[model samples]
Target: MFRRTFWFTSGVAAGVWATTKVNRKLKQLTPESLAAAAANKAVEAGHRLKDRAVGFALDVRANMAQREAELEDALGLHADPELPPARRHAAIENRNKPKSYVIDRTTHTHNRNEDH
Candidate 1:
């Protein structure tokens, strides 16, 4: 029984010594040091994000210019033919069509009634 008690006490002492060493090493890894490392990583990430955003903006501009050129080319192929002088003269007469209106007092009265 005495030998067992001695072995247990020695084991407890060794454990306490090991724990102290581990605690000392952990203390070296301070919150301030950890926070600075985190800040540096964040700054690097932000720089990468800014670079990606600029690249995307440049790509969008390139695509837009290509799309515009394609549309202009398509429109050129379907150009309208010039109208003959007689047809042009007759078309001008059609533009002077008489305009007429019926007084919509009923609609106005209905709108007012709905408002009330």
Candidate 2:
């Protein structure tokens, strides 16, 4: 008789526990709960996209810098740090100096003469 009573009590407790668990799971599966979960996932994906974009931009900048350096090396245009300041100034001045030319309209010729 005692064994029969104990088994019945145990079965009732187990049924109650299972019902509570199933109810909680059903509540979580409601429309509002599902929408909230989907919104959270979308926000997480946006953050990941932003991070990837930043990484891509940084990589492009680095590659451009490397390419510019290579171009300078190929053209032999790297400035010498040890070059004298006076020579550098003279070279800049020569590059910027304008020239005077005399054109003979009748002869259709160009001549560089100080008198002209």
Best by TM-score: 2
What is the lDDT of every predicted structure here? 0.80, 0.87
Residue-level lDDT tens digits of model 1 in 78-113: 334584333323344454555644456766565545
Instruction: Report the lDDT tens digits of candidate 2 across residue range 41-106.
Output: 999999999999999999999999799789989999886789853332334445554555545589
Q: Candidate 1 regions off by >4 Å?
A: 1-28, 77-116
Worst 10 residues of 2 by lDDT: 85-94
**Candidate 1 pairs with clashing backbones:** none
TM-score of every model versus the real structure: 0.42, 0.59
Global lDDT of model 1:
0.80
Please name the candidate that would achieve the greatest lDDT relative to the true structure. 2
The pairs that clash in candidate 2 are none
